[model samples]
Structure formats: C-alpha cells, structure tokens
Target chain A: MPPESTSNSRQKTMVIVGILALIVIATAIALYAKNKDEVGTVTENPAQTSTTTESQASGSTVEYKDGTYSATGNYQTPGGTESITVKLTVANNVVTTSDVTTSQTSQEAAEYQAQFKANYSPFVVGKDINDITLSRISGSSLTPRGFNEAVDAIKSQAQA
Target chain B: MPSSPRLRLSQPFSLKFEAIGTSWTIEVYEAYDRLGDLQKSIQQRIAAFDHVYSRFRADSVVAQIAREAGNYRLPDDAAPMFNLYQQLYDLTDGAMTPLIGQALSDAGYDASYSLQPMPIRSVPAWQEVMTYDGATLTAKRPVLLDFGAAGKGYLIDLVAQIMVQADVRHYSIDAGGDIVTVGQTLNVGLEHPDNLNQVIGVAQITQGSICGSAGNRRRWATYHHVIDPHSLTSPKHIKALWVTAPTALVADGLATALYFAPADSLRRYFEFEYAIMHEDYSLVSSPGFPAQFFGADS
Candidate 1:
C-alpha cells in the first residue's frame, strides 16, 4: 500500500509538470506573435515610397489635358540670370510641337539654345506626355543644358 | 587650292531624331550642311546597325544569338567592337560584363521598354563560358549581350566616322546624349543628374568626343540600364559620369567602367578626363578633368 501510494504521488507530480510545460510554451508563442506584429507594423518598405511618387506627379503615364501651355525656365550662369521661354502645344496628351526661344548670350550659348529648340520640339512631339522622360537625352556637356527645365516647366502647365 | 565654299564656316546646321530608344542630335558648326542627306543616311545606317546589336528587336543578331546559344561567326564590324569589349572585360575584373544580357531581359528591359512580370531569374555568370576569337564568338553556355553601355556611343563613333570619311570636318555627332566634335572647341556644361536643368560644370573640348552616362534616366521597376556583374547589384555609388577621350568608343567604354572603378586606379590602364557625381550628391573629379565643377547647390 505504501509503495502504491508513492507511485500515485509520482504520477500526480508528472501531470502537474506537463500542465506547467504547456503554459510556458503558450506564453512563448504569444510573445513571438506579438513581436512579429510589431515588426510588420513598424517596418516600412523602401520600394513602397518610390511607387507612391511615380503614381502621383512625374509619372509618364499620367493622362494630362491636351492644350497649349507656356512656361519659362530660369537659370543663372556666370554671366547673369538666363531664361528660356517655352511654348508647348499639347495634343492627345502629348507635346506635339514646342518652341524654345532663349534670352541673348554669347555665340556658344546661342548655338546651344538653337540646338535646344531643334531638339526640344521633336523629343515630346508624338509620345504620351506621361511617358516622356526628358533625362533620356540630357543634351551634350556643352549644348542642350537648360532645355530639360523648360520642358519640366511646360509639362507642369500641360498637367490637367 | 581653295577649300570648297560649302566646307567653309557657315551657320551651324542641326538635326534631331529618336533612335536606339533614345534622342539623337547632330550639330554642324563649320562644314557641309547636308541635313537632308544626313536624315536619310542616318536612318538607314541605324536600322542596319540595330539589326545586329539591338536587344529589343527579336530579329537582331543579339536576340537570335540569345535564343540560340552556340558558336557564331561574328560580322566584320563586330570584331573591332568585340575586341574593345574583351579588353574592357579584362580591365574591370568582370564588373563591365558583356554577358549581362539575360539578367537585363529577366529584370524587365526585355523588348520595347515593356516590364515583364516579377520573380526575376538569377542570371548566369557568363564570363566563365563565353569566348570570342578574332572573328568568331562562341558560348559553351547561354549568353545574351546587352551592350547598352558603350554601343550607342560606338554607334555615334561609327556615324561620326562615316561623316569624317565623307571628308566632312567641323561636324558634331550628338547621338542623343553622346557628343563627338571634329574641328571645333565647343564649351559644354555638364547637366546635373539630380537637377536636369542645372549644369554641374563647364568643359571646353577642342576635338574628340565627350559622353555622359547618368543613372537618373531609363529606370524601371528595380533596374537601371547599368548593372554591375560581380555584385549583380543596381547603380549605387555613381550617379553620373562624364568622360573625354579621342573617340566615342574609348570615352563611352571608360565612362561605363568609371562606375565600377575609382578614378585614381584607372590612370594605369587608360588616360582620360572624368567627373563623377556620387550617390551622396558629392562631386569627385580627376586632376586633369577640364571642367569647372559645382558642388551640391553652388
């Protein structure tokens, strides 16, 4: 009878340990789940930020209004404040023809300005306004410098 | 012996067009102004040239080679270009990889600027199996060629060569952003990549070509045209690079390699001038770089 009671007591202690082990494991799992939730909430993906910007303003796919828009891009060279007057004619959400006339400057400057006028018109002529990337051709180190700004200014006006 | 009056100094004639999936400009300072001839000739020349190298065109040599990976007898023109490529491949320690074609397609630059679906495939490291003899190109493994880095500038060099061969001096070939001058000192402003309209500095070139490669343009999903092969990472350090050399081929190749190499280390292999914009928006230039560079805002 003494031996049998001792055996029963051992079984009771084993059952209590089992219950305590289960409780410890459940608490550990809850903590892990809580930590996972915090990480997901706090960590913001870098990729998400870039996509947000592309969807809003500078995207080439934006369905801009078709109309004539004009703007001036201002820059400062060593000489003085320089400006290029841009007149854009948008048709079917694209800049069909652009006229860029620059304020007077040196001979090299005038050539670059002329080169800009020659290029600025055709680059945006046919494509969807949303698809146009002015940086596609950033112009030569010497020529076609200020043309992109004029394009951006005109693009702002073309935006519906 | 009087020079041809048409070859004398005259009002600069200009031509602009879109080609190779980018903008192109031709400026003639003091030479025969054959804008009409230039328009017809350049289009035909570009079409023929693209048939061989353009990855976008499925029928191109590069595309066909990618589709069928094996030994191929390269065309006559491809020899010189490939020779330069092999030299560059050796110099950059595989950083300038010609075998990065498959990676580009898988990344989304497949054809016509269309972005393919995700789960981008890990590109095979091609330098291990690809081989190029003097005239024959062989690949024991699959290799696709994207040549986006120096090909446009090479094309500009070829076009400029054609003009020079035609005895037309004082002509400038601005194949979109790459510019080569024959007989004039053109003062050019380096366009700041961060601010497209702003100039980083001004450079005066008497002759030769000046080419700029910027990461600010031609970006999609997670890829820029310039990819580093060893790391298989995106453009992280260099934002923009400008190189001046005797030809567009050298200038263009060096400009691309500059992205991988520090400007000081490159002095041993090649002699050229360069200015680079870092990822942090700071500017670093070679000692002999003939440009008046600007800092962040000033």
Candidate 2:
C-alpha cells in the first residue's frame, strides 16, 4: 500500500526506520533458521507447484517464478454451483496484483452477485487467513439504533 | 531460497462495546495487560462525548441548542469537527450541512427512532441560523446540529489518541463500519449492502482509516439516514461508497460527502482514496486504492 498522501517527512522517516528494523529482525530470523537447517522452508511452497527446469538447473530454489497465473475455483452453494476466477501476478516472489470474478449459474445467486457488486470497501484477499486476518468490515452497518425494538413493536402490533 | 517477508503474528487484546447508538471494537497489539483500565477510560470518554454531541439524549448540548438559540460553549475538540463540516458544507453548496438534523427529525430519524415520516422541512442556511468561532457557537434560532456524518469517526480517533498516549502504538479501532489501523496492517472486508453475508472485496489498511456509507441500512418510507435537505429526499444515484484517508474523520466525512458531490470535487480539499458504487452497480475507484474485488476483473 502507498503511504498516506498527507504523510510528512517525519512520518516518512519513521516509516524508513520501521522498514530498517523489520529488515534487521528478518535477517536475524533468517540466520536462526539457517542455523536450524531450515533454509529450504522459504522455497518449499513454490517449489511444490513449479515445473520450471531453469530453477533446478541453476541449483537454487526460486521462491516464485515471475508470471501471471489464473485459476477457476468451483464451489457448491445452496443456490447452485458457483465458480470464481482468480488471477494473480507475481513479481520477485511477491504478488503484485490479484483479481477475482464470480460466475453463478442460478438466478438467485445472480441476484446476490448483483447485490455484492453494489456494495464496496477497500479490502485485501489472501490465500490463507494466517497471511492476512480481517481486522473488521467497512460497509453499511447492519445494526441500526432501536432496530430490534422497532421489529418487535411491529410484530406485536400485527399479532394484536 | 528467499525468506518470506511476512511478519510474525500475535493475538491482539480486544475490547467491544456499544456507544453513540453504534458498536465499537478496539484491538490493541501487545497491550493485553493494559485493557482492564483502558476499557473504563474509553467508556468514560465516549460518555463525555455523548453528553455534548448526542441529539438523542435530552441533556446533551445538542438538545439544548435544539431547545433554544444562544451562545453555547462547546468542547475544545469541536474545532476540527465543526471546521470540517464548514468546509464540506461550502464545497457541496449546502448539500452537506449540520443543519440537516431538523430535516432528519422531520423525516423521523429523530430522537425517538420514530422512523415515521413527517412533513419535510428545508434546512436553513448556516449563516442565517448559526455561527461558530471554534470555542463559542452562537445560534440565532433553535436549530438542531447533527454531527452524525463524522462524529463516530472523530470519537474513534480520540480513543486512538488515548491509546497512543498510554503508549499503545499498535492498534485498530472499528466503530460500526469505519475502521482505523496503526502500526499494523489489516484486511478489511467490504460488506454487500443488501446482503451482510457477502462481501464484494477486501482492502488492506496500514496506518490509515477507512469508512463506508450507504443508504441501505436505515431506510424507512423511501428514506435513509442521508437525506438531502434541498431535495427533501434521500440520494439514489449511488448505492454505496467508501473512503480511505490518513484519519477516520476524513474518511467518514468524505463517505457522507460523496453522497452529495463527486470525489473530484472534494479531492482538491482532502487527500483520500475512494470507491463509489453507482446505482447501476458499476464501481469507480482511485488508482491507488488498496483493495481486491470479487467480481471486478470482468
């Protein structure tokens, strides 16, 4: 994410210092892992799926091949089977961009999908929950002041 | 082999409470031991703010202003809140006004939560009804001033300030839907307005704030919370909008302002990233907005 537009030089300096500290901490962890014979852990995930002979010929484990990859995930929902298309661009072992598009077969699912597009917030998607945990949701809150009371009042009135 | 750049994770101490007619969730990193006292302090702070700001309460300063017009002394923090409102009011040509409180009440989003529409009343111009000089607010007539647009976000920032003063550097504060993150990055889901079970996308916020506003939540008799005093009707052009700014106040205020004016009109005055979902469900967003959509790729 880009820095806040209004961030001043002081904030920029702090960010730089923070980055340096993170790098130092990362180096220490890396050294510790190497000492424990765990140097291969970083490349394990990518190496499992990779079919590239270039990395094997070079005698080095490449964390990720810089390329665009796309996949379609099909899931069974109550309405029907739904498919989601996920596209990712990786650069230097880090994901540079990502996109997900949903395809629904049923009309009910289509309606819900239409509703989904009508609402928005800035949110990040990751393959794992551990990778990026959702802090909270930013959208039109479902809760309203005295909503339950109003509902109950209407129910009681109807019953009467 | 390359080491992953991800940081180690730990559980953050969480606090949940309801105030100002909304829910508040605060998560503090490495501050688990401090939360016991911090919770009380936060509650007290919100109570104090409600005493001054809440129009629902009969004893609130806002209620006093509604009852009669006079020179009222406001809390010191009112400067930023009022100043932002003044700026937005001018920028939108009175589309966004503190004076909308009366109109809102007329539409029955009043103190009682009546949700019943009454004859709509046009909001008076700021110059005719009230004037403020940061500290003292001079009201010429009984006018209801509602800070509903950004008060929650302002309160969240105030709570964040308290946490920072207590040496809690890493934290996230979420009130209703507005959120702020500091010293930690968080993935926040963008809830679908019609269906709470679904989300359109997720956004990554680090040391920044994000707020969203939509007319779907509080609708009654073809009206939602965001009522245009001029039209005496709720805006229908946009379905929902979200903004990410350096502070929650800006994000929250702009979320409401976007209902009145386009992002380009407000961009010159505030620095923020925005995504607006039109009534047609076509999404428009800033280039640098840190989010990934569920169905935007097509």
Candidate 3:
C-alpha cells in the first residue's frame, strides 16, 4: 500500500512539471508575439506619418487657363542681379511655348537659355503645363537655375 | 598610428581645380585672402570659356557655328578650338571633319544618345560642303559640324591650362574617357573592349594626356560611333585604340580618326607608341611603346 502511494505521488509530480513547462512555453510565445506586434506597429507609425506629411505638402495643384501666363524672377550672379522672365503660352491645358523674355543674364546664362529653349522647351510643348516637372531642367545647372527659379515663382502664384 | 599635426601658415594660399564642364572648386588654407579671391576670379574666367565653347547650348559659339554650318565668326574664347579644328582637318587628311554632324545624324545619332532611334538617311560628304580659312569658316552648302570626337579632350586641355594659370600644381581633369594630368602621377586603366570589367593595360600618366577610343559602350550593332570618312561606314577592322600625347585634344582626335583609318595607314600615322585591339581580340602595340604598360609579354 505504501509503494503504490509513492508511485502515484511521483507520477503526479511529473505531470505537474509537464504542466509548468507547457505554461512557460506558452508565456514565452505570448511575450514574443507581443514584442513582434509592438515592433510592427512602431515601424508602420512613421510610414503612416510620412504619407500624411507627403499628402499635405503636395496636395495643392496649380490650375491653368487658356491664354498666356508670364512671371519673372531675379537671381544674383557673379556680374549682377539678372531678371529672368518666363512667358508660357498655354492652350487647352498644354503649354505651346515657354519663352524667356528678359535678357539681363550673364553670357553663360544666355547659353543656358538657348539650350533650355532648344532641348527642354520642345519636350514640354504638348505636355500639361501644370503637371510637367519644371525642376527636371535642374540637371543643366546654370540654365535650370534661372528657369527653375522663374518657374517656381509662377507655380506659387498660379497655385494661389 | 600617429596623426599628423596641422601646420600653421603665416600667409594664406588658394588652390583651384577646374574640370567637368563649367564647374570649379577652390580650396583655401586661410579665409579672406587675396589668393582666395583670385581663385574665384580664375573660376569665373574658366566659366566664361565654358559658356562660349559649350556645344550643348544652342547659343554657345560652337552651337552658333554648328547652326550656321560653320559660317559664324569664331568667338575669342573658341579661337583655340577653331585653330585645333583646322589642324585636325589637315592631320586626318580630311578624314575627321568637324562637319561630320550630318553623317552622325544619318547614322542614327540625330539627337541625344538617351533618345530612341530616329529614321536613318544617307548624308552627303562633309568635305564636299564645308570650308574653313583659318580665321573664318564658310559653308558652301548646308553642312553640320559635330565636334563630339575632340570637344571633351580640348576642354580638358583648357582646364589644365586654367589650373596652371591659377598656380595649382597637383591635379587631374578626367572628362569621361578624356584625361589630362599634371604634377603627380595618375594611374589610368585601359578598359577591355570585350569585357569592360577587365583592364587590358594600365599606364601611369604624369604630365601628358591619354585618351581611349572604343565603340564598346556607345554603338548600335557592329557599327559604332567612329565613322570612316572614306567609306561613310563603321570600320570593323579595329575594336579599340588608346593614344597618349602632350595634348589631350590631339590624343582624343587621333584615337577616333585612327580607329577608322586603314590599318596600314593608321600604323604609319601613329608613329608614336600606341595600343591597338583588333576585332578578333588580338592586341598589338607600337614597338616604341613601353613594355612596362602591359603586365606581361603581349
């Protein structure tokens, strides 16, 4: 009778150890899942904020009307303050011609203007005036410097 | 490792580097010095030169000349290129004409390389339409001059001169494939035409200019950018040519012209040491060329 009671006690002890191990495993898995959820949420939060910020920054789009729109901006060069005027001939939402009228630019800047006229203007002629990237010309450095400044001013005024 | 101590100077000095088109940067050891100001002044001077000589801009002197079919008067800044053009015209036996723009256009390079293929048409010979009289350039017919071959190299030479004028002793100007070096030695790796990843030869350029001409990167089919004036077609004989000279412009211009010239004639013209790669991957160099350029016996 004593032996049977000892054996039963040992079996009960083993079962309790098994239960404790299962509980520890479950707890570890739960903690790991919680940590993963926290990390995922934290990572997604910045992405969501950035998306909202981007939407806010670029939300406004400029509307173009049929007719000629012109704007001018002055830039400081090595020689003097040069004024660059951009005259855009917009018809049916497309820009026909983007002519730079003012001629206070340095000789280098003038060369920039001619290149802009020859290379860039042709590509933008049939494209939507508002949606076209005026900043793409920035790769040309000097030419883009004058043109982009003028275009940015026009873009802001048009948006307003 | 011990760090080197910074030396204190009694007077300030300015070093200026001019290369890669109109862009220039100045390094000054001291602030608010006359030398520093001079560096900026030198930069402006070079920038003005760049403006006048730039072929990318339609209002540039080169562009104006091109638009007017070499009829326009050469600007003071472009006098050097104009002179070099005349020299190259005579040197190539009229093989490398500045008026090869129509030929390049007809060979499917009418616009920028980034653009797609345009309609290819037969172009008339450049020598038949264009004429130059040392100072004045006149076009008898509608002719286009494309200085793509020698433009970058000439620009490099100009920048090297500017650096010398500015008293910058140690520097290098590398515009794409064209390179000019001064002061310190610069290691130049000659790219293999078949495999761009590998270097076929390496040369140490100390004070001279070196140019590599190959159709590996810029070409359509077997016909590459280097057009033979005699045949008006891409030559299949030579795959690559590398030349070094006192001036970058000459080296670059000769590299392109010789690639298109007949093998025998080219060998005769290139009396100097050079490395030539044949279409079948066989390589040959001038006997006078330094054997040290190649790691092993060629």
Candidate 4:
C-alpha cells in the first residue's frame, strides 16, 4: 500500500475511537445528573418542616381560664354564617366545662348540636387543653369544624 | 415444563357477588371447598329475603300484611316489625313512630320520589293511632307503617348469620349506608354531610355495625322525614348524625330517635358509649368510645 493511504487509515481509526469514548462519557454524566435531581427533590421542603415545628410547639402548651370564647367560620354543609359562643370554666390546667350559649346556624347545623354535646364536650373537661385536637370526631364533621374554630379562638385568647 | 407462579391455595377467595337487591363482596379462605354450592345457596337465600322484605313487591309478606290488616289489626307475619316499632317508640319517646308512614306518603313518598312540592304538615302524635293488646296491635286512626328504619339492619343480621353458618368467615354486609362486619376489620370512611364524595373521618371496625343519618340534597327543602314527636315537625336541630354499635339495628334506631329527642335527653341516653356529631359542627363522644378506630392524625 502507498504511505499516504496507510497514514489516512490510522487517522480515521483514532477519530472513531475518540467519538465512542465521548459518547460513553456523555451518558455517564447525564445519568449522574438525573439521579442527583431525583434525590434532591425527595428531600423535604423547608416550609413543611417549619410548619410542622410550629404545630408541635402549639400542641405542647396548656391554657385554661373562666371566660367567654367566640369562634367564626364558614359552614361546609348547608353553607351559611357560622359562629359559636362558649362559656368556659377552667380549674387547674383543664377545662372543667363549656356551655354553648349561642349558635347561629341553619336547620342542618342545629341537628348536629346533639352530637357535639354527646361526643366532644366531655373530652375537653379534664385534660390539658393542649393535648386535644378539638376537631377530631369520627362521625361528626360539621359540628367539629365549628368546635375547632372555637378551640382555636380560645387558644389564641389564652396566648394573648 | 417451566414452573408457573406458585398456586397459593391457602389464600382466601375474595369475590364480589350481587344479591339481596344490591351488590356485596365476600372474602373467605375456606370458600374454595364448595364454592359453587355456597354461591348458589347465598343467592337463593338473598332472593328469599328480598321477596319477603321488599315493599315494592305487592306480594311481599310485609305488603300482604299491610293490605290484610286494613290499618287496624297487626298481621301475624308482621310481629317482628311490630316489636321494632315498640322499641323505637320507647326510645324516641314516640318521636320515631311507624305511624308516620301515611304522613310520609302524604308528603309525596309513596314507594317512590315525588318531585312536586309538598306542604309542611304537622306529624300527628303517635299516641293518637298506636295501641297494643298484649300480642295484637291496633291503630285507632288510619296511619301508615313504613319500615325504612330497621329493615336494612335486620336484613344484614340475617345475612351475616347465614354466611357464618356457611363457614364464610371474613365478610362485610353493606346495605345502603348501613354496614355490618364479621371476622375481619373494615376501614370505612365517614362521608362529609355536605359532599358525599368527600370523607372526613375513617373508622376501623371489626365485628360490629355502623349507620349514618343525614338529610341529603334529596330531602333538602323540608326535613320532614325525621320528625320530632314533640314539635310534630322535622327536628331541625340535627343536620347529620352517625352512630356505631354492636348491631346495625340499634345504631340505626338510635340515630333516628336521637336526631329528634331533646339534646339533654339524647346526651343522657348515649352516656354509655357512642359517638355523636351535632348540627353546629361539633363532635361529642362517650368515655367508652374507641379512639383507635379513628386513624392517627397526620
């Protein structure tokens, strides 16, 4: 073979090998970048962490007193104005009793009052108010929503 | 031959079967032994029960009794219904009266829905019509007796008994919103009163029953169905109420009764152990109520 042709063939082989190496290197880099992004996204967001901390802090404090507590919110079911007036009596760190003096609600809302009296009032009687989530009732939804708003209002008042 | 996936014969056969005028799913590990025979027997038993209980069927035993008695004498076949009526009468202080059947009919519910507007009328005091003579029941006035309250639960109890006799262990019998579970625990979602699709709470129940009572959009305008005997009108005080107990019958009966009873009286009645949701968006539970049934807060 001629010397020029032999030299050209060697150059072509080098170019082909170089291109293969570049392709492998690019694939590895892409895989590494994709995996790094996945891991980063799986980490919890800062906002969620902060909110959780706040909830935990709120859950640990107890405040009880003899006073009237008011709560306002919108009703989900028979949509209308919602408000509750609770006359609270507290002895020690527990709420001794709470009487719902006034409630402005629709007919459907009034029906749930029995359930509230039956299910929720007793739980708040003797515990440190901080340990209870006023809204957690297994069957009653509308009444608990109102009761939770009332509880939040009471808690805010206590903090103030 | 290439080995196929392991044939796990021990695994329970979970199958959905439609019977009792509705659909139900049955799960049983031992169902494999006589599956075909058991299925046939179940279907037959459900059909028989439906034939006896269906108010729509003119030939049903209930309907026949209602026809023959002519609003006065109690039919022999209706003795069980009469017993339930007596219990509800005592529980609700006559608020949950079977005599309201005619009133409900007058309000446009005659076995089917009537879209026409109905005038709100006072429900007659149950004492005006119902009287008992040791074993026989007599109605002085022409009153209707609708078994919408206790019928579903009674049917579930019967079906559960049959299933147990057949050795069908893990199963749940859900009739409309009433449910009874046996052998295995069931995670049931308590639907929101406003939106049926949304679930506000979940209850884990094993070997018990749960019933939900609420005024849906269907009965929106005049809450006349669950009437309080004292007011002779719908108890506008309660929007929705759900109760769980050892039996669906008691839960259902109490739900209807409590929805109409005075708040103080109702509270005293349920002092034993139960959960109640009032209309004002408040929830109350008895000391014996189970918190574990409700899932842990997120």
Top DockQ model = 2
**Model 3 residue B250 CA deviation in Å:** 1.2
What is candidate 3's CA lDDT for residue B33? 30
In order, the interface RMSDs are: 15.1, 14.6, 22.3, 15.6
* lDDT string, candidate 1, B15-87, tens digits: 7777777667776765464657866777878888899889877898888787777888876778767877777
lDDT of 4 by residue, A1-160 (tens): 2355654444333322322222223223333434453211111211122221111112233333332222222222334544333333334433344454325466644545444444343322223223333311223212213323444554577699
Displacement of residue B287 (Cα, Å) in model 1 is: 1.7
- Local accuracy by lDDT, each model: 0.60, 0.71, 0.50, 0.49
CAPRI category for model 2:
incorrect
Candidate 1 per-residue lDDT over residues A113-135, each given as its tens digit: 56544422221122321232222
Model 3: how far residue A78 lies from native, Å: 77
CAPRI tier of model 3? incorrect
Query: Which DockQ values do the candidates obtain, in the order shown?
Result: 0.04, 0.15, 0.01, 0.03
Clashes of 3: 0
Worst 10 residues of 1 chain A by lDDT: A38-47
Decoy 2 TM-score against native:
0.70
Looking at model 2 chain B, which ten-residue stretch has the lowest summed lDDT?
Answer: B1-10
lDDT measured at residue B54 in model 2 versus the true structure, 0 to 100: 90
Q: What value does DockQ give for candidate 2? A: 0.15
- lDDT of model 1 at position A104: 48
Residue pairs with colliding backbones in model 1 are: A60-A130, A60-A131, A61-A130, A141-B188, A141-B189, A142-B188, A142-B189, B24-B176
Docking class of 1: incorrect
| lDDT of model 4, residue B230 | 56
